[model samples]
Target: MANIQDSAQQLEEAIRNSDEFQNLKQAYETVMADEVAKKMFEDFRNTQIELQEKQMQGQEITEEEIEKARKVVETVQQHDQISKLMEQEQNLNVLINDISKTITKPLEELYGAQEQ
Candidate 1:
């Protein structure tokens, strides 16, 4: 019937104009969910990059510190060797002075005996 058709058309038009409807709600929710997913993925990617950079920097600093420690060890070893050599030279000088004193003592004793 013509009346039924007209009523149905009016009902369709009213549904299209109404904002408090069920049909658009699903679409809006899907759009908002997509935006949230995009933002989360971006944040995750940025955090991963930042972490990687920090790890790289830490590795470089560790390597530098290791190298510095090696140099310090080498310097200490060199100084230790130098100290040993200096001690050996001082011992040799003391030995030479003892020999000179022993040789001069006999000469002085003979000279005193001749004078007496």
Candidate 2:
């Protein structure tokens, strides 16, 4: 377990130093440097958090709330900086997902259903 923990820490460091993470950080910084884009992103993020919290609580999110989120997304999509940031974010997400799959592949193979 200690060895696993050490390896996990090393993996985290490697991820932090990866080009995908660096690109995402740069894109995030560029978006944050623009005041208008920053404010818009904050609002969108807040709304998303609220919606997620409500869902977690088994509460219904109103259509108006959904529409508000959609409008915010549409507005943000119009900005090149925000667009680049989103693209970088998606790329980072894909990288993370790939890492997760790689790490779990052995267990999956061991317990996976056998094909007919």
Candidate 3:
């Protein structure tokens, strides 16, 4: 229904204006402002994506690749701005997950499914 579309848009705007989203944006900007932190964060993210892609493609992940990813994560975790950014990201993910569960309640009710 058109009303549902409008409600969805309102939810989107609310999410965009949420504290979690704002904090995540600020933290991301802070990390990007520092060249070293940005590079380290990018490398870490790329390593994660590579591993996830391999997993999704049913390809074997080499021990060397795992070790490399671990090292990249460690290095990135040592950077304050990047660490802050990662924390904010986690917070935002939690908010999104909560919102998803809330929105899916009708389906759960229809199916008589117990809340997880």
Candidate 4:
């Protein structure tokens, strides 16, 4: 059991020191463009939902209705793009957390062992 724990800690340290993990952590932290994209997507998705609901409720739509729907479609496209970005962010977050735990677990174990 002690050997198993030590091996796991070494493996975690190795990944945290790896170039790929370091690069990903940097990129995820520095990227600000995703914020704008996410906001735009939310706005579009909300509009699409509202317009679709109104159309479904037998609201009398005129020429303005067509324009509104078209706008909603445009927003839907933007939302799709944003959703993709959000998915990427989610994936990166999970990856980062996993890697961080691996990197720090040894230190945590040491502290815990000392306290015991």
Instruction: Return model 4's CA RMSD, one decimal.
Output: 13.1
lDDT of 1 by residue, 32-116 (tens): 3666543443444464465567677874435664565555444433553333433444554565576567647978788888895
Overlapping backbone residue pairs in candidate 2 total 0
Q: Where does candidate 4 have its weakest 10-residue lDDT segment?
A: 24-33
Candidate 2 local lDDT, 38-110, one digit each (tens): 9988887898899999999999989999999999889888988888999999999999999999999988988
Task: Give lDDT: candidate 1, residue 43.
Answer: 46
Residues 20-87 of candidate 4 have per-residue lDDT tens digits of: 56755654444335686546656666766776787899776678867966775566455545545455
TM-score of 4: 0.36
Sliding window of 10 residues with minimal summed lDDT for model 3 = 107-116
User: What RMSD value applies to candidate 1?
Assistant: 46.3
lDDT (0 to 1) per candidate:
0.52, 0.91, 0.91, 0.65
Backbone clashes counted, model 4: 0
Clashing pairs in 4: none
User: Which ten contiguous residues of candidate 2 have the minimum total lDDT?
Assistant: 107-116
Which order, best to worst by TM-score? 3, 2, 4, 1
Candidate 3 lDDT tens digits, 31-107:
88888888888899889998999999999999999899989988888888888999999999999999999999999
Q: How well does candidate 3 match the true structure in TM-score terms?
A: 0.92
Preferred candidate (TM-score higher): 2 or 4: 2
If candidate 2 were superposed on the true structure by all CA atoms, what would the RMSD be?
A: 2.5
True lDDT of residue 63, candidate 2: 92
The runs of at least 3 residues in candidate 3 whose Cα sits more than 4 Å from the true structure, single-residue gaps closed, are 113-116
